[model samples]
Target chain A: MQDLLFYFFAVLTLIFGFLVVVNPFTRSPVTSAMFLVLSIISMSGLFVMLHAFFLAAIQILVYSGAVIVLFLFVIMLMDLKEEARSTFQGIRLTFSLLLAGLFATVLIGVVLTSGLGAEPVVLTLEGSTAVLGERLFNAYIIPFEILSVLLLVGMVGVVLLSKKNLN
Target chain B: MVGLEHYLVVSILLFSIGALGVMLRRNLLVIYMGLEMMLNAANLALVAFSRFNDNINGQILVFFIITVAAAEVAVGLALIVALYRRRRTTDVRELTDLKL
Candidate 1:
């Protein structure tokens, strides 16, 4: 059952991710952003399969919900001129794809040799939001507070950057 | 019997595609989307490792990563928008004003 779910989402994620990257036609950022929503949702599903239920929820709520909406909002705000409507051609295309292929081959080789994933360590990690909350409020409290501040700074920076004719 | 290797393989494939986008595509927004994809690939690997190790720390790190990623997207999109407004183009190839 778990394997079935994993393969389903893994394939879905890769397809959507490919669509997001180099879909042949309509290289519109908006289209890619929409596909990205699907990809993120699939990744979130994978997280659920991992039994990190809270993280999965956060992934969907934060990534697919907030981040993708932000991406769409920006795509709409900018006057996108159907940017890069054509596919890559000639040497650059082959070169980039070759590089990507080389990278994948190397990475896969490393993973095959590492054997880190072969045997999963048996340990108890309760997949409960309550436990996560307790840790967030206790041991990881400082970093969590710091992240809030970072978000505040980001908000301020975005407002300042996007403002027109700021005196 | 899907294991950590499966997740890592998926992640590396996603990462490579993202790198291709960043390298081949001229449009800055597409490149930014690729960047997001790469970040997501990393996040997936982190979650998988956490799961395999049966540790909560990896998931905890993922939470922080999400928060930081949100901030990054907010600021990054703002910068992209501002750049487009100034130059009337999102093509990085043409935004070479700082060429030396």
Candidate 2:
């Protein structure tokens, strides 16, 4: 059952991701942005399948919800002139695809040759939100606070950079 | 249950898509989207490892990564907007003022 959902969501994610890359053809940033949001949300579904519910929520909330909205807003604000199309020629693109295939083959080889391997030490982590929260507030507190600081810095930097252009 | 290889293969494919987008696409915004794709591929790998290893720490790190990714998108899009305002184009080849 869960495996079915995983494959379903994974295919959905791959489809939307492909659309996002191709949607630039319409010369519409808004459309591409929307496809990107769908792709992220589908990826979040993959996270949920992995039993990382909190991470899934954060993925959708942060990436699909907040960040993509910001991207759409910027795209709407700008006077995009049907940005120059992708530059890679057919030969180069074919080579890239071939290289990507080669890399995948090598990765599969490594994974297969590494043997089935010992069983992973599966900790008792399910339904343990309390433990997750406690650790977040305790051991991971510094990095957590640093992220907020980083957001602040990013916001201030944006304002300053935009202001420089105006004056 | 889905095995770890399934997750690993999906992530590798997604990461390659991002890399190809970066290498082949000429638009800055599209390239930024590609970067997001790469980050997401990494996030998938992290959560998959967390699941297979049965540890919450990996998921916790994913939370931090999401935070950083949000900030990165904000900053990157803002810069793209600024660049658009100044140059009127998002073409990578043309935005070479500081390329030296």
Candidate 3:
């Protein structure tokens, strides 16, 4: 049962993710954004399978709920039309694909040959919310505080950048 | 039974696809989405390793990563929007004013 569920979500994730990148049917950014939402949801399913329940919920809320909506809002605000299909230069496209393929080959080769371990170890600690919160507030308190400051800076910077006339 | 390698392989493939999108797409928004995909791929790998290693730290790192990603997307989209307003197009090939 678990194996079947894993395969289902995994395939869904890859498929939607692919659509986000290279949808043959449409060149609209909105379609890609929507596909990205589906991909993110399926990834959260994989997170749940890994027993990181808190991360799964956070992934759904933060990613699909907030982030993708932001993308849609921007897309709507921009009123972007479907991109022309001929934008892809043949040589550049070929080079990009070749480079990406090379990267994936190297990484996958390292992963397969690293021989970390085939057998799954029994998880002694599940990533429940309470434990994650404790760790965040305890061991990682400084970084957490810094992250908040970074977010504040990001917010201010965004507002400044979006202003029509910076006086 | 899905092992860590299975999860890692998925993560690798997703990252590769994201990289391809970033390279292949002309629209800046699509490129940004590709960046998000790449980040999510890294997050998946971290969670998988966390589970197999029986450590919560990797998950904790993912939490930080997600927060950072949220901020990045907000700022990045604003930049894209601002650029669009000035340039009136989202095609990367045309935004070459900085090219030397």
Clashes of 3: 0
| Candidate 3 residue spans exceeding 4 A from truth | none
Provide the TM-score of chain B versus the true chain B for each model in turn.
0.95, 0.94, 0.98
Better of 1 and 2 by TM-score: 1
Candidate 1 structure quality by residue, lDDT tens digits, A1-167: 88999999999999999888777657778888888899999988888888889988998999999998998888788777765444477898899999999999999999989987666567467656997898899999999999888999999999999998656
Model 1 residue B13 CA deviation (Å) reads: 0.9
**How would you order the candidates by DockQ, starting with the best?**
3, 1, 2
TM-score of each: 0.95, 0.90, 0.97
Candidate 2: misplaced stretches above 4 Å? Answer: A83-88, A116-124, A127-129, A164-167, B98-100
Per-candidate DockQ vs. reference: 0.77, 0.62, 0.83
The TM-score, computed over Cα atoms with residue i paired to residue i, of candidate 3 is 0.97
Candidate no. 1 TM-score: 0.95
Write the residue-wise lDDT of candidate 1 on B1-100 in tens digits: 6778888999999899889889888878889889999998998899888878878888889889998998999999899888877788888889888999
Each candidate's chain A: what TM-score?
0.91, 0.82, 0.93
Best by TM-score: 3
List fnat, each candidate. Answer: 0.81, 0.57, 0.85
lDDT, residue A85, candidate 1: 49
Among these predictions, the greatest DockQ belongs to 3
